[model samples]
Every structure is written in C-alpha cells, then in structure tokens.
Target chain A: MVDIPEHLLIKTAEARAKALGISVEQALAEMKGEAEPTTISKEPEVIDVKPIEVKEAPAPAAAVKADIPAEVDFAPETRVTQRLLTVVKAKPIQKPTSEPVDKVNTWPHLMLPEFISLMAMTAFLIFISAILQAPLLEEANPNITPNPAKAPWYFLGLQELLSYWDPQIAGVMIPLIIGVAAFMAIPYIDRNKDNKPSKRKYAIMLWTFFLAGAGTLSLIGILFRGPGWNWTYPWIDGVWFDDLLDWVHFE
Target chain B: MKNEKIKFRDRVKDISAGLGDSLKESSLWGSIFRPGSPFRKGYSDSPRNRSYVVMNNVLYHLHPVKVKRHAVRLSYTLCLGGLSFFTFIVLTITGIWLMFYFRPTEMAYVDIQSLQTSIAFGSLVRNMHRWAAHIMVIVVFLHMSRVFYHGAYKAPREFNWVIGVILLLLTLLLSFTGYLLPWDQLAIWAVTVGGNMASYTPVIGAQVKFALFAGLEATEATLLRFYVLHVLFLPFIIVIFMAIHFWRVRKDGGISGPL
Candidate 1:
C-alpha cells in the first residue's frame, strides 16, 4: 500500500463525487469501504410488541349462509314455518319492486301539464271577462222590482224548495237537518273496502240522486216561483201553494 | 426557456395590474350600488337551526307532520279534489283584497253597488269571489262523495269523517254569512226570512234567532255579525278543522288502499 497526502485525497474524493453525481460523504464512505453511510442519526427505537385482545366481528356472513340452510330445513316442515316459508318463497318469485301503481286517477294526482293547461284555460276565460267588462245588471233596484231578481244559480235549488213547504221546515230547518245528517252519515253509509269505482255502485247511485234532487229542486223553485209577499200568480194560482213557492224564492 | 420566463413574468405583472384595477372598480361599484343595509346577525347553517327560523310562521300548521308522497301527489293533482283547497287560497287572497276597499256596514249593499260600477276591477273581484265560493261548495260536496265512494271514511277515519261534517257546516255558514253582506232587498229579505225560520226551532228557535241577528230585525248589528262570522269567526274554525283534517289523513295511513 502507498501512502497519500490527506489534502490530495480529499480533493480526489470531491472530484470523484462531482463526476459520479453523488454527495461528498457518499464517495468518502465508499472510499473508506463502509457498507452504509452514517446518514440517519440513530436506529429507530423499537416499539414493544404487546399481545392484542381482538374481539371477533359479528358473523353476519355466516349467519346469512346459515339462513339458507335454515330456510331449506324450514321448507320441509309442515305447520310451524309454512307461512314464513311461503313468504320467503314468494320474495324470490316476485319481480323487483319499482314505482307504485296508480289505481284510481283521483283529483290529487293531476300532472303539471294538465294543471298548466287548466290554469291557462281559466286565465283565458278571466281575460275575456276583463276585456268585455262583463256586463253587470243595474244595481239590484229594490223599489223597481225586476222580474227574475233571483239568487245566484247554486242557491236556486234551495230557493225552489221554499215553494212546497213552510220556510221554517223547508227553507232553513229541514235543509240544515238533512245537510247535517247527510254529512254525518257519509262515513257510515259508504263503508265498503273496495276503492275501485265499479265496486262502489251504491255510493255512486246515492250521491247521484242527492246531487240531482238538490239541483233540480233548486232550479224549479227559482224559475217557477215569483218573489216576496202575496204568493198567488195568474199562471200558478193556488194561494197556499203560491205562498209555499214564494218562501222558496227568498235566496 | 429564458424567453418563456420573461413572458411569464410579464403575464404575472399584467394579471397583478388587472387585479388592482378590478379592486378599485369594485369599490366604486359598491359605493354606487349601496342601499340602506340592515344589520344582520351571523346564523348557524345547520338544519335544526334553520327549522326554528319560521317558528312564528303562519303556514307552519298548514302542512301535516308526516306526508306520504303518494297521498300528496294524488290528493293535490289529477281529478283535483284538492284544487278546491287552492280555490280556497284564491278566495282568501281576493277576499283580503276586497276588504281593502269594502266597509262591512249597513251601507254594504250600496258599497257593493259602488264596487260593481265605480271601483276598478271591483265587480270582477266580487264575481270571482262569489263564483269561487259557489264552486268551493260544489267541489267540497264532490270531494266528500269521492271519499265516500272510495271507502276512505272507514274505521280509524271515522273521527275525521265527523270533523269533515263539521267542516261542511262551516263552509255552508261561510256562504250564508257572505250572502247577507250584500244587504240588498234580496239579502235583507233572505236573511229576515231565514232568521224568522230560526225563530221556529221548537224550543231554542227564538234564542237562536236573537243570537244570530242581535235583535228581532236584521239591522246593522246583524250585518256586522255576519261580516265577523264570514271573515273572522268561521275562518278560524275552518282553519282549525282543516289542520285536524290534514293531520288525520296522514295518521290514517295516507289516503287508504295499497300504494
């Protein structure tokens, strides 16, 4: 082995490091025949290994697998699992659940398009009314009696009912009583389980009769009867009958 | 690479100048656009906090606690039995509008006449209100019929049915009270006759009549009574009933039958 000067050795090491694109310390360490450079401060402190107490996770997967065998076993049973097995069997047979089926097209389910169209039609009607300033008859001149100074169309039916009976019985009392009774009876009267229109025959018929009777009676009373005091008319002459009819014309 | 760096530096300088100009411009814009700014408190963005924002809201009770989507869509759409409810909202709007100009006095008849002829769109408002009122009655009847036909009033819904009956009477009362407000000969006579008829109720007829009219004849007091009943009293009753009605629908398995 030949001896070399420390300064020259350091210069040569620097040159070699630059050429190799390595750090000076790396080259120096390699020249010294060291396996690894003393770069890191110290070996990382070893952590103590303690035994872990691990609780097993719930056996959901095993339970699911077990359920199949349990179901298979249940399938052979006659009484105990019959209903449950039937339900389970049915689940697989059924198509996947989707959106609900609409049974009767009731009022609350109006589509946006239909609602818009309805609103448009209503608006158009209102516009036409506005444009026309829809003629209003002379301000209900009480002194100068008009021929058919009638109640609005809806009340005309009730007005007609006034003609046939006493105002107390026919006009106010009877109607009120009947109305309250009818209203109270609604739930009781139509207690069928069926929601289909076809199944509700009696209910439909009863309602139809009620509507017709109310509307027809009101129309007849309003149209035929004359207004206020002294019921006898030239055409429909009986005094009491005319009085009854006049009672109906109050609205 | 040198050229690119120079270009990048110039771009950065340009961006910095632009940003400064924008900041200055924004200050001027802010000054110009500034209106009277009210003081605002910081609020929590959590949903539970948001819910309390409308604690005193009028429409809080309008909606039921729990609603099945199907029930809402069905009840509010299609055949539109629920459209009657919308009509009621319209009635409320138009009614309040009418009240702005109307005086519920003995002069109500003449006031109505003036509204018919003199006020702008007054007759239209009146007519719409009148027609809507009538339509509401018809629609309600039809709705009841539909409910009956569908067997929606059975079992747990029986109490609701009873409530519905009360609602129907209230609706009729609303119509009747409104009718007397016009105070024309028709209104006067109709109410007089109606009052007299009440006087025939076997035992409490006269008392009922007196309570209703506030006197023997249908006078200013009667008009005021009817006005209060029409606008305030009956409305309160109906609203309370309506809340129960809607809530019951939710509780009773949401309109019945299979979904």
Candidate 2:
C-alpha cells in the first residue's frame, strides 16, 4: 500500500475525529490501528427510528405467527436489534484509486530545454542581423508605383491566387472564409479521437496538400514573378522580390 | 594574541559567514523569499520542495509542479511555441529601441537612413526587428501545424485551437501593420497592393479600404494609422488573446499526446 500524503491524512483524521467526537490524535492512532476504536455508550442517548414500534416489547418481530402450513419457516429466531450513530463519511482505510502517472518535476526537466532554445534563437537572430541588412528602398512616391508591387511574403500566395481568379474571391472571400474560418473549424470538423499519425491519414493528406499548394504559390510569388507580375524563372531572370534582395545578392 | 596568529583570509571568511547567517535569519529576507525558494536558508532537495519550486514562484507558476515525462522530450514539441513567444519578446525589445529614433511622418525615411548610418546599434536593431518579425510569422504557422499533426486540438482542446488560429491572424496583422512604419517605397507600395485587396470586400469594401488607408490612398495619415496599430493598438489586443490562448493550453491538459 502507498503511504498516504500528509495533507490527505490530516483531512481524513479531522473527519474521523468529528464523527467519533474524539481528539484528532486519537483518530489518527485509531486509523493506524494503534489504538482501540471508540465505542459509543448507549445508556445516555435514545435512537429515534422513524418506523413505529413498541418500546421494549420483548422482540415482537420474533413472535410472528408460524401456523401457516403452506409456507416454510422464515427469518431468524434471535431477538436482534441495531441502531444508527453519527454518520462518518471517511473510509476506514485510505485507498488510492487513481493510477500512478509517469511524471517528472517540471522545474529542471522542462525549463532547461526552454532556456537553451531561447539562447540558440538569440544567437541565430544576432548572426542574421549582422550578415543580412534589412532592405529599405527609396522614400514613398505614390506617383511611382514599383512595377509588380507585392504584398508581404505571407500574403503573396493570395496575390498569386488573384492572377488566376477574380479579386473578390481570391483576395477577399477565400482568405476570410476559407483561410480564417476553415482553419479555425479544423478541430471541430475532425472528430477523430485517435491522435496517432498512421490513424489520421486523411487529415495528414489534406494538410500536406494544402502545404504543397500554398508553398508552391508563395515560392512562385516570392521568386518567379517578375515586373508586370509575369512568370520568369528565378535562375535566369534573377529574383525580382526586393524583400529577399539581400539574400539573393549574397548568393 | 590569537587574532594575530589567525590568517587574514580566514578572519575575512569567518566574518562573511557570520554576515550570511545573520542575513538569512533576518525578517526581511525571510519575508521576500518563500519557503520553497532555492534562495531560502533552509531549502533542501525534497519532493515537497521540488513541487514548491514551481508552485510558489510567480514566473514558475505558469507551469505545473510536474508534467508527463514525455512532454519534456525536446523532439516532441520542437520548442516552436516557446520560440515564437521568445521571438515576439525580442521584436518587442528591438521595436521599442527603433521607436526611440524613428519619427512616423514623411521624415520617416530620412530617420531610417540616419538610423542605419549614424545611430549606435541602430541598423542592427532594425535588422533584428525585421528578421524576427518574418521569422515570427513562419514560426507561429509551424507551431499551429505542429499542434494539428499531434491532434492536440481534439476534444477538450478544440477551443484552444480556435484561440491559436486567432493568435496567428493577430500575428499576421501585427507584422503587416509594422511593414509600413519606415515610409519607404518598398513599405508603402507593398501596403498599397495589400490594401487594394481590402477594396474587394463584398459590401463594406470601400469603407474598409478608406478606413485602413485613412484616405483615398496611402498618405501621411495612413502612415500614422499603421504606426499606432503597429506599436500600441494591435499589441494590446494580441496580448489579451495570447493570455487566453496560454491559459487554455494549461486548462486543456498541457501538450497533447505520446503519439
């Protein structure tokens, strides 16, 4: 048997003490089987059982008629009686019902990895900042719109969609309805309780398909699309995306 | 005579040890660090103390006392979520530093040029901010994908996934708003093309576009608008959603599964 936690032991001891009208120390000792159980003295108190019966009637229940020949003898011959006392909710012995989990203290186990990752990220960020200067083109001139002006890289896929479909659907509706709403609704829609990758093949396939499509479109938008949003092979045309000019120039 | 015989180093060590004992017994020190703190005088390596190490501290309370053994495995989570949050903190620090030198008017361009040229650590900070922002978008998206693949969003965790999606959108908006702050040709034109998409919204298209641009087109007003949204408004909102998102993660039974 597992040793009871100190806090739980105290709680049970308190409950037992209150029920038996004994000191908590005595209750604990009784629970440990070191002391005898506290017995109630029956002389001082009267038990009020709701069922109407005569007082001290020499066990009238045991004197029932036995003259009926059709039926065999019933019940016990002894004049037995029982009475209720204070209701004690605590069990006689502590039982740990929950399965013991495989767990470790989170202080050193989880935090060490988190701290190391943070340090690595900081080093990586500083390294990139030193090498690749963030592009800052000339001042804003509304009159001179850069040919093939592009959105930020994340939205570049939507811009690519705009070339194939109407702007209302590609730019507005698809991102709002499909991108935001559908993405949010994934967990609710996928009712599969099993989390194993092999068991969730359909979801994996759908996401992979989306990943491939989105990746291809965004890559094309970021690298292949030249002046006038026309397709150009990045290797021959030289990449037109100014956002990545530092990295491209480095290459 | 005995003091004269003792080494100078030994006397200093004895005095310092007495001071340490006195400080530990002081009421102020006792009040500051709780019982479970490693800094506490009587702290010892015990199961109860280990649990208290996390539960008793303000920062450590963000985590539970113990976690499923597998959750601590670095390969399981890839630490993408933590990296995303850390990148945000980095951007926030660097962004604030950039703000000290940057003016959000037409002078924004001149300010940036001088920042890269004259100011100490200016160009590097700006580069950190920009690259971190870009990295944040990718990291946040990857975190979501990681959650999905783990099916961490199932059953009781479904609502947290929705919150995660909202956080991702907020991240994108935060990045997009910051893009226009430099008031450069690259900044304004990219924003213009993106804002043009807002004009295609079904009914309130024109209103939304006008509201976003703060005029018929990108102007000084639009720059001011983006600056406020970038620095103040969006961050305030995102932090609230992020709080709920993180709280929900703990409430939904930590990270997902062994599988």
Candidate 3:
C-alpha cells in the first residue's frame, strides 16, 4: 500500500462526492476500491488531462501563471470530478476584451505644437507687410479707364477664361458647374475606401490637373495679358490699350 | 536681550503667515484661474485638466484637447488652412486701421494719397491689409487643394467641403469689393469689366447687373453697396460658415489621417 497525502485524499473524496451527488465517505470508499486494484496507473492520466483542460479555458486569463493550475489540481483522489470542476471554473472568470490604449494624455503634447505654428505664421506675415505697398493710381474716373484693366489676382483666372469664352460661360456657367461638382459630386464619384495616393491614382490625377489649369490661367492673366488684352509679353509697354474698344467690341 | 529678540521674531512670523493666508483666500486670485494653482503641491495633471484648459478659455476652445499625432504633421497639412485664417485676422486688424484714414467716395483716391504721403504709419497699415488680403486668397485656394488631394472631402466631411467652397467664393467676392474702395482708375474700370460679365447671362442678365451696380453703370450706389458688402455683410457670412467648418473638423475626427 503506497502512502497517499491526507489533503490529496480529502480533495479527491470531495470532488467525487460532488460529481456523483453522494457523500464524501461513500466517494472515499469507492476511490479506495479503485485504487486498491489500479494504484498509480490512473494517476498520470488524471494529472495530464486536468492541466490541459485548465490551459484550454479562455476565461480566467490571470490563471495563466505556471504555478496556479498545478496547485489547483494537485489532488489525485478523483480525476474525473476535478476535470468537471475545471470546465465549470472556465465559464465564470471574466476577461478584459478591449484593447489597451497605451497612449499619453493630451496636455503638453497637443497644445504646444499648435501654439508654435501660430507664432511662426504671425512673424512671417509681419516681415512681408513691412516692405510692400498697396497700389492706388487715380480717382474713380469712368472715362480714362486703364488699358488691360485686370481684376484682382484671384479673379484673374476668370479674366483669363473671359478672354477665351463668352461672359455667360466664363463668368457664370463654368464657375458654377465647377464649384458644384467639386463640392457635391466628388465624395460619391470617387468611392475608394482608402485615401492612399497610390490607391486613388485616377482621382488624384484629375484633381491635380484641374488645379494646375486654374493656376496656369491665373498666371497668364496676371503676367502675359498686356495692352488691348492681346498676346504681349510682360516686358512690352509702349502701346497701351490702342485697340481695347475693338478687342472687347464696346464701340 | 536674547529672549526679547526671540519674541520679536515670532511676532513678525505670525503677521506674515496671516497675510499669506488672506492672499490665498482672495477673490482676485480665484478669478485668475481654477481653485488650485499648478504651482501648489496638490495640483495634479489629468485628462480632465487637459480638456478643462480648452473648455474654460474662449480662444483655446476652438481647438480639440487630444489631436492625433499624424494630424499635426507640418508635412501632411502644410498648415495652409490655419494660415488662411490667420491671414484673415491680420487683414481685419490692418483693414480697421486703414478705415480710420480712408474716405469711400471720389475723395477716396485723395484720402489714399494723403494716407501714403502724410498719415503716420498709414501706408504701412494699408499695405499690410492689401498684401494680407492677397495672401488670404492664395492660401484659401491652396488649402482647398490640400483638402482635395488628401481625400478629406469624403463621406462624413462632405458638407463641410461645400461650406469651404462657399467660403472661397466669399473670399474672392470680399477681395473684389475691397479692390474698388481705392476709387482709382484701376478700381473703377476693373470692376466695370468684371461687373459686365454678369450682364451676359441670358434672360435676367440685365437685371442681375443692374442689381449689382444699382444703375446702368458703376456709380455712387455701386460703391456704397460694395463698401457695405466688403466691410460688413460678406465678413459676417464668412465668419458664420467658418465656425461651422471648424466645428465640423472636430466632429469629423480632426484632420484626416492615413486611410
């Protein structure tokens, strides 16, 4: 007869009692009968299955420590009942499902960057304003209009368009259509899920060309269109609007 | 004599302690900031404190508490949108100063002459306003290009993009209106050519042009109207839409990140 630990015997007897719905004494009698015949033959099988069951349980994540499950199932008295307990224990222990943030709180991190950008921008504006002067030529005279009279630089794009198209199309129809399409239709028209430039090649290419066209037109209107709104280089200055009435057909 | 000196020193300490206590409990100090100053021992840093800094201040509230690191990258945003708004602020300040010496009628040209020739720092302010206005136009367009290229106009941000388009139009209109305020030949004829473009619309074309100029031509009524729009109306509209635009940026998860 091999000497079995008193606590192991007690735990085994209790596990059997619970599994069979019988008293601990009755379970202990049955375990003694089985042990007398089989001895340590069933011991390894019980130990192996108990640890595997505990390991497979997704719950009780904290029990992942190597020291815990071995101590929990050290009792060799009733292997079948202890296996049942492992399954039962797996259900109740709650797990933390959400991802951990691992992020720093936004105090000095966000505010400092914004403040620095604003300061740099203000300094640049002050430097530019110090040197240049606004243009003011003569009083409001309806008669003596300047030759190649140009709109403000922003509207120079429209002025450039006016050179090539009728006023209704250049001023109203084209701008209205472009504005509406850019704002309203773009989101639906380009339905790619990702924003990577490589992923959205066609969308990126079209918008780039559209912007380039507008910029180029503004540049031509600003620098290239000279007197009479003719195709004259910016350097030429002698003949000023000699044929303005003919070009615009104002008569 | 040593005991007498000790008593006097204790009396001085007592009075100074009372003064410090009173200052700590004062309403003036409380009015300056929240209850406990950060310099105090128990003052702690927290997420709530970070949010409170923005919530409690008027100007800082315009920004969000926790912005993603990618959104603030200078290479990604180029800070074009922020620069546009900053330029508008510069314009407002310089524009107000220029208005002090500017006359809006035919005398507007002479007033500008005197502003350049006589008024102290007048030309500097006018120049600042003019250049700032031009910079704002260019910057707003660049900002639009940045938004488009980033695909920032997609899905939930769609409406904000529309508001941005309207804002760009207002910016152009605002610049055009201010252009005529100088009342120079350049101002008059450039506006004449621009306004005539509206009259080319089909059926209601003449009516639209008349409504714009207030007569058959660009005259006193037209100048007054343009002044009102440039100074008051358009600015009001821009500010209202800009508020919506900024609030939407926060609502739409700050600036767009990668994908």
TM-score of every candidate's chain A = 0.42, 0.61, 0.56
- Candidate 3 has a TM-score of 0.72
- TM-score, every prediction: 0.57, 0.76, 0.72
Give candidate 3 regions above 4 Å deviation. A1-107, A236-251, B1-26, B35-48
Best by DockQ: 2
**True-structure lDDT of candidate 2:** 0.87
Each candidate's DockQ: 0.10, 0.39, 0.26
What's the residue-level lDDT of B150 in candidate 3?
87
Of candidates 3 and 1, the better by TM-score: 3
Question: Cα deviation in Å at residue B1, candidate 1?
Answer: 61
| Per-residue lDDT of candidate 2, residues B1-259 (tens digit) | 6776355324322222434877887999889988787667766656687788789999888888888899999999999998998998998899899989999998899999999999999999999999999999999999988998898899899999998999999999999999998888889999999999989999999999999999999999999999999999999998899889888888877878888
The lDDT, on a scale of 0 to 1, for candidate 1 is 0.61
Candidate 1: misplaced stretches above 4 Å?
A1-156, A166-173, A189-191, A197-200, A227-251, B1-79
lDDT of 1 by residue, A71-127 (tens): 454223232211222224434666777766444222112223345644853575465
Name the better of 1 and 3 by DockQ: 3
lDDT for B185 (candidate 3) = 79
Q: lDDT at A223 for candidate 2?
A: 87
What would the C-alpha RMSD of candidate 2 be, to one decimal place?
18.2
